[model samples]
Each structure stands twice: as structure tokens, then as C-alpha cells.
Target chain A: MEYIKEPMEIEERSFKIITEELGDKVFEEREGKIIKRIIHTTADFEFADITVIHSDAVEAALEALNGGCRIYTDTKMALSGINKKKLTQLNCQVYCLVDDEEVAKEAKDRGITRSIVAMEKALTDKETKIFVIANAPTALFTLCQQMKVGEVKPYLVVGVPVGFVGASESKEVLLKQNVPYITVKGRKGGSTVGAAIINALMYMIE
Target chain B: MEYIKEPMEIEERSFKIITEELGDKVFEEREGKIIKRIIHTTADFEFADITVIHSDAVEAALEALNGGCRIYTDTKMALSGINKKKLTQLNCQVYCLVDDEEVAKEAKDRGITRSIVAMEKALTDKETKIFVIANAPTALFTLCQQMKVGEVKPYLVVGVPVGFVGASESKEVLLKQNVPYITVKGRKGGSTVGAAIINALMYMIE
Candidate 1:
């Protein structure tokens, strides 16, 4: 008899390889899921070492996804990485302000980053529960400042912007924020990581 | 008088910030373009330190783009980051194998990475001039291996897979390859970087 594997089976096998490789590192329920997804996305095991997930981050993100809360990302790459078809079933929509003309104009007018302006616009919607910042540290910094001033409160913040400038600094602010969050310490995060966390939560919700 | 900045102006301003931040480094004619685009894409300056570009990489990539060569990437993010509209004008198309069911099947059947199988499939087309491996070191390794065996001879290889595993090793292989290449040494790259290089070349082609 000949054996055949489907695409889904291949993906499962890939996950198995990841789990076997991860062995004994991430045993926590939520942390394990997020880490697994990150590894799956990047095929990089270093994430297991760098990723810092708030104990309640997965739960908080799951709740938001279940409640059909609006999802926002700082980069279109994150926006594109998310499984929109799956989210649509739950009546959730993903938004990215980085490419918005209005956000760009506002950023220019206020002498701020477009991501900051997009975050400001997202705050207009009280239902915005999840924030994924994957590219710009300035956006993450602005979010922390806004949260500090009680301008907005989100259920979960995925702060994973990659860079040398303010990536670590902004993530430090997120770590200090009184909110459920998932971040990679230092300067090693990208839209792929951000989307992986969200996708992991989405997969776990069902 | 009040001044209004258009979207293009804002983009220019963003580039200016990147250039100012990148100061004193990367002033070369070609290297500057690639580095600027990487900074523009990720808002990261450290890329200037990590990225290693062959002196003729940009020239080779530009030639391929002008000749309407096909672009191949390991991830969808890289595929999405590329300026498809611009590539279309040059009669070039981008290919990503990770999402293809056939490629997945081949990967499973051969017990090889899907990206590797994708690269193999891509090699079937002699016109595939540019290769971008953004998220998988295994793909880069496999490409280098195939290139060694005379299976494929891509005009330019943009090898920027980020990870603790095989990332640097595969990039080292790329560096040793007798081919025009752009790679970031060690573990500091992703789909964004891969796409930025291609987009930079596309912009330069025009």
C-alpha cells in the first residue's frame, strides 16, 4: 500500500517537528501555544527563549476573539498574516493603520508616526481589544503613553516590533503596562511574530 | 499660511528620518538604496550593521528585473511586500511555494522542507532569476545545495532567513556561493527584509 499525506498532514508533521524540538522548554498552557505558533511561523526556536507572554495573555486574547472584538495591527504584514476568513466567522475584522491616508495625514500633522495616529483612530472604537505592533517601536511607545493617560485600555497588546532604535524600549513600556501582553524582549520581533500570536489565539478559541 | 503634506510627502519625510538615522554609514550609491529600503520597511537601523550585500547584488538584481525575470520567495509575507504592480510592468511574477498544495505534498513525500521543495519546483523554470528566502534557513540551505549540484543558477539570491537555527549556517553557504547575493549575517532578518530588498531593486529598475 502506498502512503499519501495531504497538505494539512504535512503541516501537522511540521508542528510535530517543532514540538519535538521544543521539548521540555514551554510547558505552560498559554505560553506553549503562543511559542509553538511563533516557531511554526518563523521556524526559529530562539523565540522560545525571547518571547515573554503575560500569564493571562492567551486567555485575554481568546476572550477578545470570542467576543468579536476588533483587531488592530501596526503593519499591513501583520494584517495580511492573520487568518481573516476564520476571524470573519466570529464577526471579527482586522485593521492596519500604517497604510491609511487619513492616518498618514494625521501622523504628518501631529508630527508623529502613522502607527501612532492609527492607534489614536483605533481608540475611537471602544471595542478595540487587541493591539499588534510589529514594525514601529514609536507606535508601541505611543500606545504605552496613551494607556498611561487612560486614553484607551485594550484587552491584549502584542508588542513585537523589530529594530534597534526603540524596539526594546517600547516593549519595556508594554511590559510595565497593566495589561495582558505578549512580547519578545530585545530587538527581535516582526509582523510575522505578531500575526503568529493572534493566529494561535484564534486557533485556540475554537 | 497652513501647510498641507500629501501622502507622498509624508513618505518622503519617513525616508528622510531613516536616512538621518542611518547617518555616517552606508553612503555608497547602491548599498544606500537597499539599506534605506530596509530601514523604511522595518524602521530598524541595526540592519545597516547586520546586512551584507555583494557589491554587484543590486546591479545583478536590477538587470534581472529589467529582463523580466521571475522572483521566488519562501514566504507569503515576502510575496506581499514586493511591489507586484511595478513587477508586472517589467513582466515579472513572484512565486511562493509554501502555500502550494503540490509543494506541500512534495515536501512530505520527500521528507524535505516545503520551502526546499518549492525552490526545487522553481528551478524547473530557467527564467527564475531572483530568489528570496526570508523565513526559512532550510530553504536557503537547500537552494545552496541545489546550486552546488548545478540544478539551479539563480541570478541573485537574497538570503535573509532569521532564526537561531541554521540561519547563519545557511547564510554562510549563500556567502560562499559563486553567485550575486544579499544576505544578513547571523540571525536578524525576516520576510520584511527579503521584500524590502526586492522592492528596492524594483524601484531602482525604474
Candidate 2:
């Protein structure tokens, strides 16, 4: 898809659904400069990987895709940008936090499917990862639970969640599932980031 | 566990907290107000739920907990709030906005997680209740995916993430998840609104 060159900047982070003659793609502009662009392509390929100039750009791109997509974020800035609302809204089940059950619940309520387990809630190996994503301290009991349950496989978890409150926890949930899946390298990856990663993976598999 | 009382105005959404002082129970502001100062007793609940006087009070309360707490806003507000470095810096997440992978990623990078679901992804039965929160029309697909997945559980995966782009997708994700959740009661909800609801649930649960 081709993008028009008229870049606009807004102090608040927001999106503009600019349509291009070639196709529909998302772009990020800062101070009249097009810092990033997420091109929307046919999902003919399985996996795809794209670079992000700014974290917000990732979310913009992800917002334009279909469902059943997973996502990942590698940076705290990107993760927090998405927020709990975004995560919950995006149907995320995992979240990584830095606090207690209250924090975890808050993250979960915000659409973070999974959350980091706190020091107080850690129980087994599985819990360790959950806690990590939740951004909470790891515990022993959780580790034990995973050891007993064995690894969950063929995990059909979606990560393209917009909320980053529990991005860490979401990732950990996938990890605890003990399945091979796609995820963004940083913590702020959005629906498109997940889509791109999955798209890239699908390409590799195909 | 004890609180001291300074003369404060009692409102609809007010409560009180009790603290032990010199072997005697003391009453402090837990949430509401009593007609007069009374020695706190075990029969009195330690914490009380205050009646909310102003609609904006909800947003104010959310802002007060913005630092690292999970929050949910409507989609419009969620999108507008993206790229807020200071707010993003907090270890919290927003569950509003529908899933727009691009926006989701960008918001994450900016420390904002606007809720959304991409249009290029797939959906399955197991992936019920979770959706890409976003604007109208496109969010329909997200909801369809949840219905196909047999999302029977009420509120389990529901969110009304408000704000701009991915508000629909965020809410769709929650519906697909089929897990118990909370959101604003009326049409006023957006993608981020779900996040706010989730935040409230977290607070209540905590």
C-alpha cells in the first residue's frame, strides 16, 4: 500500500485513518514527520515482521486487523501505552504487574488475560511465569503446579491485546502454557505487532 | 489499620476506616460519613463504599490511581490519551479502545494500551469472549467470532473499552472470552470504558 506524504502531528497520541489510493495502512506522524508506517497486506502469508519507529504506531496498525491474532511487547513504554483497558478490550488473558492480587485483578479486569504472579501468590513453576508477566515476584508454589501439570500445548491464546497493563503477564501465560507461539520482541507490541509476527510465522511455516 | 478523623464533608459515596489507638478503636475516613463521631467497633466494617456524587468523579478516581494501577476508559478517551509519556510511565494498563494492532503497538510503545482486534486475524471457538476493541462496523467481526465460539458465560470476557479507534474491538474481545467482566451500563461505553470497568472490578475485588 502507498501512503500520502501529508504528515500531521498531535500532542496527544491518537490515530488518523488515512486511506491511500494503493490500499489501507496505518501510519504514525510526529511533528509533521511520518515516523512509522504499518502496511496492511493480504493475510496470504502466515507470519510477518515489521519494524516500529514508535510504540503507538504498533497499536494503530494492530487496530486495523482481524481477530484470533496473538501479540507481544518487549518494552515497558509500549506495554504501558496500551493500558489495561486496551488489553481487556483486546481480549487478553495474561498480564504482568509489579504488585499484589489487587493489582492483578485490576489488570485482569482491564482485559489482560494473564497477569504476573506476585511474591505472595507464587505457587509453582507455571505461577512463576504468570507472576513474571504480571510483573510480580516469582513464587515456588506456582512452579510446582506447572511441574505437576506438565506443559500446556497447542495453546490457542491471543496476544494482540491493546492493553499493556498486563502484557508481561500475558506473555508469561503463553510461556507457562509451554507452547511455541509468536510474540513481539518488546513490551508495547500491539495487535498488528502480533499479527505481523504471526503473519511472519505463517509465512515461514507455509 | 487505624485512621484519625479530621472534620471532613460527608457525601453520598463516603465510608470510614477504623484504627486501634491505645487499646481503643478509633474511627477515621473509610469511605462515608456517620452522623457523629463514634468509637469504631468490630461490628463496624473496616472499609465502606462511598456513593459517587459526580460522574467525573469516576474518571478522577481513575486518574488518582493512574501511576501503576490498571484503568479502563472509553475508546475516545483511550485513543486521545495515548502518547502520554507521564501517564504511560506508570506501571498500569488501559482496557478501552478496540484492538487495532498498529495503534495497540504504538500505544504500547508510548505506554498506552488502547483496546482493539485486527481485521487480518482469525477466530475460533476456544477464543471466545476475547476481541479486538475498536470503533464500530469493524468491531462486528470481533463479536461474530465470539458468538461462533459459543461465549455463553456472561461478563467473563466482556469490556466496553471506550475512546476512539479500537473501542469496539476491545469490547468484542471481552465478549468472546466469555468470562465474567464489568463495564459501563449504557451506550456511552467505548473501548477504554471497558478498561475503566475492569479497573473498578479490580478495586472492588481488592
Best by TM-score: 1
Candidate 2 regions exceeding 4 Å error are A1-206, B1-140, B145-154, B161-193
Per-candidate interface DockQ score: 0.17, 0.02
C-alpha RMSD between model 2 and the true structure = 18.8
Candidate 2 chain B weakest ten by summed lDDT: B35-44
Residue A72, candidate 2: alpha-carbon lDDT: 29
Residue pairs with clashing backbones, model 1: none
By lDDT, the best candidate is 1
TM-score of each: 0.71, 0.24
Isolated chain A TM-score, each model: 0.93, 0.27
lDDT of 2 by residue, B1-206 (tens): 11111112111112232222212533242211221111110011211221112223334343434435433332433333232333355554444433455656654565422321322222322322222232232343334454556643222333432223333344434433433333322222332322323333234222
lDDT of each: 0.80, 0.30
Docking class of 1: incorrect
Determine the TM-score of chain B of model 2. 0.32
Share of native interface contacts present in candidate 1: 0.14
